[model samples]
Target chain A: MKRRTFLKLATATTMSTLAAPYVHAQEKKFAGITLRFGGWGGLYDETIQKYVAAPLEERTGLKVQITAGTQSADLVKLVANKENPPFDVYQADSAYMVEALKADLIQEVTEAEVPNIKRILPGFREYGEYGVPYSVFTYIPIYNSELVEQPLTTYTDLTRPDLEGRVALPAATFDTWSLYLLALAEENGGSISNMEPAYSLLEQAKSNILALAQSTVAMIQMFETKEASAGVISDARGHELRTKGHPIVSVYPPQGIYGATSYMNVVKNAKHPEAAFAFLDQMLSDEGMLGLPRALRLGVTTDVKLPDEIAKDLTFNTPERIALKKKVDWQKWMADRSARIERINKILRG
Target chain B: MRYDFTDYVLIVAGAVTRVAVYALLALPAALVVVLSFTSGETMDFPPAGFSMQWYQKAFESEPFMSALWTSTYVAVIVAIAALVIGFAAAFAINRFDFPGKGLLQALAFSPLIVPAVVLGIGLLYLFAWMNLIQTMFPLFAGHLVLAIPYVVRTVLASLTLHNRVLEEAAMNLRASPLRVVRRITLPLILPGLLSAAIFAFVTSFGNVTVSVFLTYGGNVTLPVQLFTYLDHSYNPLVAAVSSIMIFVTLAVILTIERLIGAETLS
Candidate 1:
């Protein structure tokens, strides 16, 4: 072979090697696809944009358009647009997931489509194949340590004389209130089906209750204002308060803490199914799971190891801690929630 | 010079009542504005320290800013639409009599009598059936329905207070019907039109119950955004947003007052 021919071939090989990565990078898997994600706004949406959407877009070339709203609002929109759903993927709490499933508004997800589903811890995968658990939070007793003399070790402490007119309980409409009722019932001898014991306990503690907070934010305000000395609150919120120098401490009662999981589901008639799956897959990834604890201080379902600082505050990430989480039959609880809530209202008002 | 015990007592009672009403209305807004300046992370009365950090956050937030823009855009459209339709309807009711005139007048003000939540749900269902729930059109339409009644009521009140003799005299002087409306009738009712437009704008801007059902796909209004924010986080950011709203609303009221005098509203 001639020297000129060899030199020309060498230059061509070098040029192709440099250009290959650029060419591959330009060929995006979801370049043209835009996935519509419906979920809670405020911090949740901000965290999702920072952690999930931005990263997913960079990885797969998928563009995300977020529609922020309450879970019920999103569900209403989904139901309203059932024929041509506006959102490709919707994130909702477990209770609302049940509603979505019953209404046939969401599609079942598969491991093949979302490979990161395998990363979630056992039992965290909820709604069968219809939904995947993204974040988990445990509701436990939280109190301002400076205000309460005695350290609360169990849910029964809420009924103590010292807590009278100082305890802040979640309103009957809040998800945490139902979990608190279940925990109270289980601690006493009643099961999930029979909330009589819970109602009785609440009736006894009625005089102690300062207020029934309408929301988690309201619950936090109760603590901030010193209106509440002790109350039932989420572990994540408790951690957040403590972090903000609020003197609050979260206690996982010996009776066990109740867990609430937020699930992500694909709409039944999603316009961009593949892009939706890509987004869900990112949520289950190690990067995705870790973002929850980092951004929102919430627990993740995936087995991704958390940083020591974040892990210390989480209650359901470890095996021993997971064992202490009490699982309520949410489907059963939701089915009879209206009557239970009415009974609770009567008990609290009694 | 010779006021009796009952007269003095009644004067004192009226003064006390006026003061009480003013305090009741102004105190909460004043409190919210004060709380907006808190340096602390959470909202608390007599806030820990004074800072404009929350206002900074409010300005920096994309969701709040986007909702603010959406609200302003929609309100302007609603105000214009309500003004045009309401003025037409009010003019017809005042100047002409037709069959079912009573029914038409009743329908014009029916939204005010109907419960907002019921109307919201009804609109939601209707929009859903029409496959129009996903778009911002429903929100605009819902707010227009809510705001039209105020427009009609105010315009009708203005028409009643102002004599039609000027309009009749103008028409009798060889002025065309449109010319009378443009020159005489419109000028006399200009203040009422301004009042109605402001009322409609504020009504559309601050609405939540109806807008809540119609909002979708990143088209949330500011009030709904604030409401949803309360579900997860409690911070001075909400207070700051609210303060901005109050200030903007005050500015609008002041502008209207400057432009058309406050007594025009009466």
Candidate 2:
């Protein structure tokens, strides 16, 4: 009886030892893939690299080469050169994705390549297929609490004479033009469908704006200097500033807000498209989305639970706010009126 | 009336006014330097605080340091290469009467008139065709093209202004042509050569628009790095880096002065 018991124990130990390598191999597979990705301005890249790239590389054998210099002009230039592309994947905000898709600069990716698509909030998934929603960036108005006794919460309040010269708007030729059009449409009780009134309203607002900035970070810095009393800025950046102890309050204006989402789209002809998609799928998983707000230091996804402080500042999850958020027909804006936009910009500068 | 104290005072006042106007004219450059030093992460006229942290940050970053080192070597090489090639070309143009002299001069100066962006694009396409993409050699070739015009123009100017008959006199004294060139002709043109070298180096160092499209993932120039950094975020780090660049520039000027005195050799 004792001999039989000893043999059985030895066999169980052998079985356990044999399974260990299989488990080890599985863990190692996750870490072995390298992803080459590109994006617009590099702030998010820096944040994502620190939070996502490094950890993901260590945890899964997946390494990532994060490229961040792919601005609008670079995108256009890269797309124009069809035979060879410099990047394996790129991040395009909602508007540019349309341009990229239309240009055939990128290929359409289905849910199969991105299994975590199921985990994404319904609204975000339904919005577009060009990219996986990484962060919902928008121009949120921030006001100095010390100067303004009553809180300012809407875009229309910017026209108040008291706030006239103190207002800062993004001077980005594309974003500013779009925002002006949207605000004008909102003010005139019209939908984002029409841009004629948008143009007229933009002209009116052009008169009141004290200065225009190439970046929202610049606008925030201007606000911090007490040079400007109020400005429109990205929600993520606004939250970052407020955390640094600036007496700034972000308001998602009552008329509605516009959202510019950065999405992760695999390069059309990536060298390792399969491995790249696998890593991307991990990025979209429940665990992945949860990690975003903390790792990215931005607003969290609506469906995913985030820290209370982050949730308060983020607009992704709010049902009412999401309903009011409008999409820009960037193609129409780019095609029909880019020249007109340039003319208006010149007039404003003049 | 006869020279009075009031008239002298008025003349001094007028001189002071002119100096002020020049100062005002210099103000824009002064502002760029000051803004380059302003100590805030993001750019604002008056800094929230002052710190050399950005300089420290810039040097700490691997890419910026590598880019700086790359540009320094590239500029030095380009200046020397351009000077040698330009001097030969300039001498051939000035010393001999050749057919198509005007056309050659125009061709040599052509790169200067070409917009840097167009030149950059042309070079990009040409280099890609030659399978030189993502290589420092292309940058060297492109920068050499940029530097040639400056060097040629300077050397040509010196040839025009200096006394060429002195070299002829040396030759008449039984000095060999090589000896005459070494002792008389070269000395007369040394200042122009030095000026051209400095201009070449400056042109290579400050270039961004041309370098941007050319730089791939692994290779980058200083101005290209700075452009990327500024584009992403406006931070005092950029100012800090700019300030350090200004100091380095001053140091370079001083070193050059110590080697070749401020007075023109001619």
Candidate 3:
């Protein structure tokens, strides 16, 4: 036999051998079927394809087709075709999941449907009925260590006069602004019910904020150029920027971190329920749990042993960290969102 | 020209403003092209060093290549489809005086007035109601709707500029109506049709907002892919991919120019 053919055979054999135990009866039943997914795009899509899709496909003979789009866009598509959704499974972040549930765009998932739900931590179980919280990310204040003389402990610190003209914040139109706003509200003696205090603090911080970034990429660009020495960003993003050689440290406030959870949901009237369940279950599996966090530096929903280096960076699923995660009542947050947005826009834009 | 201090300050300020505005518009694109050649892992503006590894990585990746192919073919199809429909409509509007000529013209140009996000959502619902959601039909149809207006406008302008004397002369002879149209009308308007085709291609190719709504099972265009990529992560790969996208668009334009002659572009 040719050397290339021999190597190919050996590689295939090793892979199949490794993927043996994951090949369950359900996966066998769903063989040759294609399961469509609407997902968070970019590297996340690659991560899913590499870890979740490949293994699931190998085990089940099922193909996973991930349609790359934002969570809000996915919901719009679902509402447009509520009776017949475009995908079997889709992703939604914390804010939009409420809208998805209220609109009945996604159906409920039982423990039996996704057995891995038991592995999920109690703190992340707020919306377990509608979807599975596969990953947990948080909004924390990240500051450039070289530029910041004193580290940021809370959102209030971002408005300090010393950091004036060196701090960047998300623009009103950016979706992630809501997540940061919740952290400000909780830390500034306000709740989801009342956001006046948060707006008052933001009014004061106007002088300090150098730029209102139009997007996440713009925020990161601000940091790279030292135009933004301090800002409120997600722990995942902070970790990513750190990896990319930015001299920033993510600070977990004494109060708590604001959770920005990502949920995986089976759409209402999904074309392939069995395959969808199997995919969701695999995501919560030991290997599956590692797949997501490894890619984005996010904390896993399930209690899977992570490598020492990664475990140190993650700020979720642990007892102390979970307690530190302050979640907003998304239902209350969404109500009068436009009015609230206009109010903040005035404060920030001023 | 001897200038006073005030005049000198104004001249300097004017030059400075021009340079700043130019840089503001051009720098982001320039930085992407530069970063695509970076040896570093991240998207550093000045670029840590220089390399072609990212370009190599871009070609190897399946998702980007697949998206590129999808964008190219969709844009090409949309451009051709727009041209055919546009020619017919423009010809009718130019030659005849219909009852609702003004209204029809307004309707043709209305997509430009409506925001893309609204149009995208409206089309999504419309396509869904028609039971044409999952197929690639929505994507193609949505892009076609967006591209048609530019096509109609361009073709109309071209039709208006043509010498009617040529077509009349053809008719004055024993030539048929079809013969006059084919020989005189089409040949005179080739450049306009080319311009309209290019406009349609650009409108369809660079679309993101509507494409986001119309994406079928893993069938996404290049611009939407880039937009979605930027949403979740930041890296040199994005810069490299963007550079590749620029190259692809330029190649399409150049290829068309080559086939139709440089005068078509002019």
Candidate 4:
């Protein structure tokens, strides 16, 4: 090459390298745009703001307005204002997603809009093309390590003589009772279509039930106080009790664990679609995916590497682990919810 | 010196009942406050260690502080509005006969009988269809509906107990009705008003159901915030937030006591 040509190329390259930051600033075209997000509060919201929203704001000059609200109420807000959504993105759990879809309250986006959609575990994308799971919770059997002599392998084991009058389970009134019912059903050769087997199994287990706790807090307290020798609870909650110096042990049942998930979806009539999609891409990114796992021991949906200690305390931490995690058929469950709740109430409350 | 056996038994039972009532009323709250200082992750009873980290987090948290502020201002506004409207309605009902007086009385106390769930959804759908939920009016109105009944009841009771002769004397001396009300009636009902304000304040502040349906993103009251938090999961921070809430209530009571004598509050 001629010296003149080499000099020209070097000078131009240096100038462009110097102007790269300026070019990046220009690419931040969404500077004035604000994306509204409806999400969980407490540690969950705090973690999202810290890990996903803040960095995205700095990188793209777009602001995220995160509004904390009850999940069901939030869906009501969207349904009430279906023509003009108040939020651009929202965190929708299973029941909310079903109802939102029925009401046509959310938009569907493909991998073209959000590249990270490809990274979301296929099982966690059970909400179809509308949303992807950001974090997952597991329903696992637990027992008082110091009180119970035998290890529990299945929900059927709660009927064992050792667990009689020392077992506690969630009442039908509890929001997440379907998962527990499904576990019992799956273990007894029935599924969501026929939860009848689980009820009869529950009848045998009834003699053992010290109480059907009305809430998760009640369930935890029963375990904490050793009032319950063996039962089922959220994996994170069990691990939390263990972390807090309780004698609780999480048991892996033979059929595996039940999956309860929280998802991030774009609102149907979002004012800022590109910005909302960008925010979603970051949520599925490695940094954002690990926030819940780090904060609350929730399993990450994407294949983000977690510290071994954190992974050990969580469920669905890998594709293999997720493969074992069964997502509930929320539609069928929701449809039969009233009848099931009534029957379970009679069985458990009795 | 010479007490009857029946008298002694009655006295012993009375003493026992008083202690039992105090233990039932106060011990649970005291234990919760004690658990709030827990250094451990869970807010279990009889905490293992002590730490102010939760309180520190509560004060530092933007969402918590914002929600606290929202609850405070919302309660303050609702209480003030309920106080004015309640005092007027109670005075009018107490002072004069009107058409549909019985119906008006029933209407004032109607909210107490109607379930809060019904009211919440009623108000939510009422203003929600108009898209007025973007403003704070829906929450304010809902709280007002829930709070007005308490105020009206308290003020009506106060007005009934008020001496009518003083107002008559003031009027006979050529004092205007407004002046008589300002001078004689209000001073007499001061205690009732004070107590009623506290009722309204606490009612709006601690409300969850109606507020839950009405609250938007930034306007959530403290109770709804805590409710949603617990709905998702429970953490020690809840205890801390609750402790702060108790402290705020106590502080408000103390401030009122200082401003108006405790006897008046009682």
Candidate 5:
């Protein structure tokens, strides 16, 4: 009887030990602390705070504080004080990520740290080691449906006298340079490998364009505010406004549009890295993407199966769309361009 | 001043010329204000239609309202503090013989000469080191740097106008120094203080560069908010709000003018 009783106690203890990790895993406590995060400006940050931060804090007893518009320069400045990272995690655009990597301002995360790695699309794996691609958009042509029945297909369309002073383009050189290159390539068969022809086309486009907006929101204003008949904007935003009963429609012209992605990376010496990783893991998973489509009106992340309407409008995996994206050589592209952009800006101001 | 036919033609011609010059100056502001009311689909020179929808939208937007309030609050506080501190400093420099008075005057107005971006960077570092980022204190301090010059100039001008004999007369009557200053000096400078405060308030209110670097998202001031919005979207909504601001400013100026009368205030 004594032997049997002892064996029962041993089995019960073993069962409790096994169940403990499962219960602990369910608790969402990462190193027994909350997370601090930072992100770029706009709707994406809003969605994360609304759906992800609040729910995670409730479930895990780990509070999450979000700071938006915290730039990469802020992080680079903070890295010297290794003991405390002002932000436990922050989002960096690809160009900013390149700079961060060079400065050793962000740490790398292996698959072990983020088990949701397999959920991301293969195309996104390139960015997953040090950063994870959170959102994507194509810089496609957006036009007023009332103004044009047919899509504005090529860069040359912008120069049409009828469309002159009505067609708006992204004003930023970073945003428009690739389009300029593509315009040059189209002028000479198909490839923007050189710079001289691109400049000529850009100068021409500059002369023809009505206005340039820095952000999609700005471009949207060109149409909504009646500043321009049409503009170049992310396809996702175009579809979003259309869904909202706006007159704007995103057009995927015969020639492909430039594709861009926004990413979130871990700061090198983030104080609450576990919290950061937990938030990152959540954002990468199917659970996190649930809130974005409705709140932000952007296409879902890679793991998300595009909703029927979204899939129809978005060119997420289209081969042609992928091919047209010029590899962003920020060094070459942004080189000696600040002054040039300013000079062009001055003429545009006139 | 005898009237003649040539004189009548000259008078008419002068009036027309005056009208034309005023029209030239008014045209830009009028155009911007007109754009504010437009419901046109594009931000073009000649708007398609006139509508107050943008103004309604701006009023409804929480961010814009909050930013407007924050800017107003900060401007008022900064104006009052700057006037007090700056008037005192200016009075001391103008009235008393003190060591390094010239240096103090230069330092007080130095921010006016410095580039706004440089001032932003310096203040950012100073505030960060002191662990005061995201607070109103730094913003107030920065605005003071911009505002003190106006106060100094106005107060110094006021001091230059009043004779030393008034104070000497009060002293001769056996009145205390503090009593003489309160009765004689302060009353004489009240108008100048009021003028300086108004200038400081407007300067702080309309500021962008210094406010932009200093602002965090939650604490976005009005000009920064407008600038960001303008960067992303230019429409009649921003124009409408701007027009309202211009009207309000004009109203304030008119009120001041009526109270003091232009010649006396000057």
Candidate 6:
């Protein structure tokens, strides 16, 4: 009907098609750059490699090399290689993030560099610029519903006479042990600084505990073997146990659930800053935030809503649940961790 | 054939003790092998069902495969190096009376007494100071230190047990010292050398504490990988990996026994 309009629309379509690849090519500008990332091993590393690293490399043409280690070991490497950092991007738990920030091992990020940062839940974004929140999990009481008769509402329930010789406590060396201690302190009318009440209560509950588990895996084993009926464990692990048909359920206590967050930071003297930023930005994206939950049953830090099935297991997704997460002064707690651990150990022994 | 009450009791007690010892040694390994074949996702005793899916998963995992290769490569190198150095040291200590020989002997076995964690940290610091912490050199060096002690101990025991008469006779017959050692001393100790080599290989292959500190970049050993994996999850995949390791180690020992004879190990 109109020859001029037809030619104009065809040309516009052609121009837009040509411009699309150009824009895509511009996004893949970090080609030839190799980004070295340091993080935890096992399922976490595998998940990130599959869902985050591989996809990021395919989209951006940037190669990613992952190095996995324990939290302390990774921190040691970062500190050792400070002048010329070994990792372009490093993953750290919330507690170690404070140490990394204090030592100036990692750098700050703005929304300009990581646009998806804005999508993170408001509560989990308190690390400021030093670290980006990747996942959130709560250390709460997990019990074998078959063995436990009364509903477990709080940490104090662990001391109940019925749970005698059936409760498992995390060892002093584990990170969650600190969270458990903090929760116990809050429940027993002692703050993080003054954990005397917590120690006394734990001492009183000592006769009830079966063992001080070396790790969350050990705690899970205890539950599986029926060696212990109840123990403090991460919500993710509880979900894993439940999924495995282990009759385990995680209870968010009335006092408050101790929340722990894992974070990713860009090393200060990064070899390839742009590539690191790009990888980090991808980590915070809708796709990136979904990987943790999908791969490891971990709680996502993003405000991105998950399917109802997964959301039901996660502890701190909703506004109300997030409000129930107890906030600890990690800096102060980490400072007194050794003394607190020693005190707790003494109580357990006695 | 008639026995008193005390003699019969002793016989029964001895039989029970032997059975208990065997069970203690064999049950855990059997349990691991059994669990590796479980169809269920979790690691449980009296496994839910029998399937080889975990073995396939173990083989397909990139990290596990890489770690297996790294451990094998390092263990092979460590075994060779430890054997050479240990043979020479054992020969020297056994043949000659040198100054500070006792000190050298003590130093060689020092690794056995020092906690692995201590040695690991010390090695980490030493490697960092030398600017070699990022490379696989630390891992190689640390494992060599650990492996050397077993080699030295086994070789020394062999040297002590065997008579030096043949070696002396070879030396007296105008054969050079090197020739004497090659012709007489070496053959006499070949069995011990083989045993020591196996010990060194196994020790290096299964090391965890030192390797944990020395592992850098992507150079983790299998044991370190397994340990790290256990921290994250307790699936039958670990059992599968352990079973593979046991099978490989058993195959190696069997192959060596066939080539060298089981009497040599004894």
Question: Global lDDT for candidate 6?
Answer: 0.85
Query: Over the stretch B124-165, how does candidate 5's per-residue lDDT look in tens digits?
Result: 667777777646777788888888898888888888887878
Interface RMSD of 6: 1.6
Q: Is 1 or 5 the stronger prediction by lDDT?
A: 1
The DockQ-derived docking category for candidate 3 is medium
What local lDDT does model 6 show for residue A28?
84
Fraction of native A-B contacts kept, per candidate: 0.48, 0.13, 0.88, 0.32, 0.00, 0.48
Candidate 6 residues lying further than 4 Å off, grouped into runs, are A1-25, B1-11
Clashes of each: 1, 11, 0, 1, 7, 0
Better candidate number, 3 or 6, judged by TM-score: 6
Considering the two chains of model 1, state its CAPRI-style docking category: medium
Tens digits of lDDT, candidate 4, A235-317: 88888788778888777764777757788888888899889889889989998887778888888887777899898787665
Instruction: Give the least accurate 10-residue stretch of model 1 chain A, judged by summed lDDT.
Output: A171-180
What is the TM-score of each candidate's chain B when compared with the real chain B?
0.95, 0.87, 0.89, 0.95, 0.86, 0.96
Model 6 lDDT, residue A47, Cα: 87
| DockQ of the candidate models in sequence | 0.61, 0.27, 0.73, 0.50, 0.14, 0.55
| RMSD to the hidden true structure, all candidates | 2.6, 4.4, 6.6, 2.7, 5.9, 2.8
Could you estimate the TM-score for every candidate?
0.94, 0.82, 0.91, 0.93, 0.75, 0.94
List residue ranges in candidate 3 displaced over 4 A: A1-27, A173-176, B1-28
Candidate 4 is graded, for docking, as medium
lDDT of 5 at B182: 92
lDDT tens per residue, model 3, B1-266:
88899999999999999999999998988888999999998876578899999899888878788888999899999999999998998898999998999998888889999999999999999999999999999999999999999999999999998789989988999799999989999989998988899899989999999999999889988888888888888778888999987787778788888888897657
lDDT of 4 by residue, B1-266 (tens): 88999999999999999999999998877887898899988776679699999899889978888999999998899999999999998988898998988898899999999999788878877887887876789999999999999999999999998789999999999999899989999998888997888889999999988887788656678887787677556777888899888888788778888988998768
lDDT to native, each model: 0.86, 0.69, 0.85, 0.83, 0.67, 0.85
- Candidate 4 segments exceeding 4 Å error: A1-27, B1-4
* Candidate 5 vs candidate 6, DockQ winner: 6
